[model samples]
Target: MYATIGIIVYVLLYTLINRKQINQHSRKKWIYFSLAICAGAAMLLLSDSSVGWLTKYLNNTIGDLTSVVISE
Candidate 1:
């Protein structure tokens, strides 16, 4: 649930970011800054979720692969 919400939030943030004009060399740092903020916020939103629960999303096989890759 939370994971899905987080993913949705991330996608929304991505769309919002892409619609803006932030592709200048002078604002290069803002690109990373915005992405970091979006990722952090989305992760925090999904922090209550369990890994197993999250892996049950649409991309079941891919989710399992990602879980293994991120399992530290």
Candidate 2:
């Protein structure tokens, strides 16, 4: 319901913003951003009661990535 509307609005807004350079290539980038936003929104919505858990998970993920980069 709301998610569907949100996706529709996002598509409309994205199309308007990239009305010029929105060919096949750049359009793929838009789809990626939209998917990221949708995933983030879904996570937040599903874990509204687990904010602390999500924060720690995200922090650990970032820390691990940084550690790997630093080690390499």
Candidate 3:
């Protein structure tokens, strides 16, 4: 309930704040990525289970990227 509302509010706030960045062709991808991050952060902060999930997601992603970069 609260998490859903918080996610919506945060998304709207992020969209407004980055509207100009989003319109820039080169920044479109980054803009969306930033919004996705904002949504993830908001969810993590709003929900107890979300924190554990987000932590695992971030750790795995970082670990994978590090391994790939180090292996190369």
Using lDDT as the measure, which candidate wins? 3
Q: How many clashes in candidate 3?
A: 0
Task: Tell me model 3's lDDT, rounded to 2 decimals.
Answer: 0.78
The best candidate by TM-score is 3
TM-scores of all predicted structures: 0.33, 0.32, 0.43
State in Å the error of residue 58, model 3: 14
Clashes of each: 0, 0, 0
Could you give candidate 3's per-residue lDDT for residues 1-72 as a string of tens digits?
Answer: 687677878798878886886887686888788777777776556657855877789879998899899999
Sorted on lDDT, best first, the list reads: 3, 2, 1
CA-lDDT, candidates in order: 0.66, 0.68, 0.78
Clashing pairs in 3: none
Q: Which residue ranges in model 2 land beyond 4 Å of their true spot?
A: 23-72
RMSD per prediction, one decimal? 10.9, 7.9, 8.1
For model 3, the stretches where C-alpha displacement exceeds 4 angstroms are 1-4, 52-72
Once model 2 is optimally superposed onto the true structure by TM-score, how far is the C-alpha of residue 41 displaced, in angstroms? 17
Using alpha carbons, what is the TM-score of model 3? 0.43
What is the C-alpha local distance difference test score of candidate 1? 0.66
Order the candidates by TM-score, highest first — what do you get? 3, 1, 2
lDDT of 1 by residue, 1-72 (tens): 577576767767775777455554477577768766666666555555645475567467786787889995
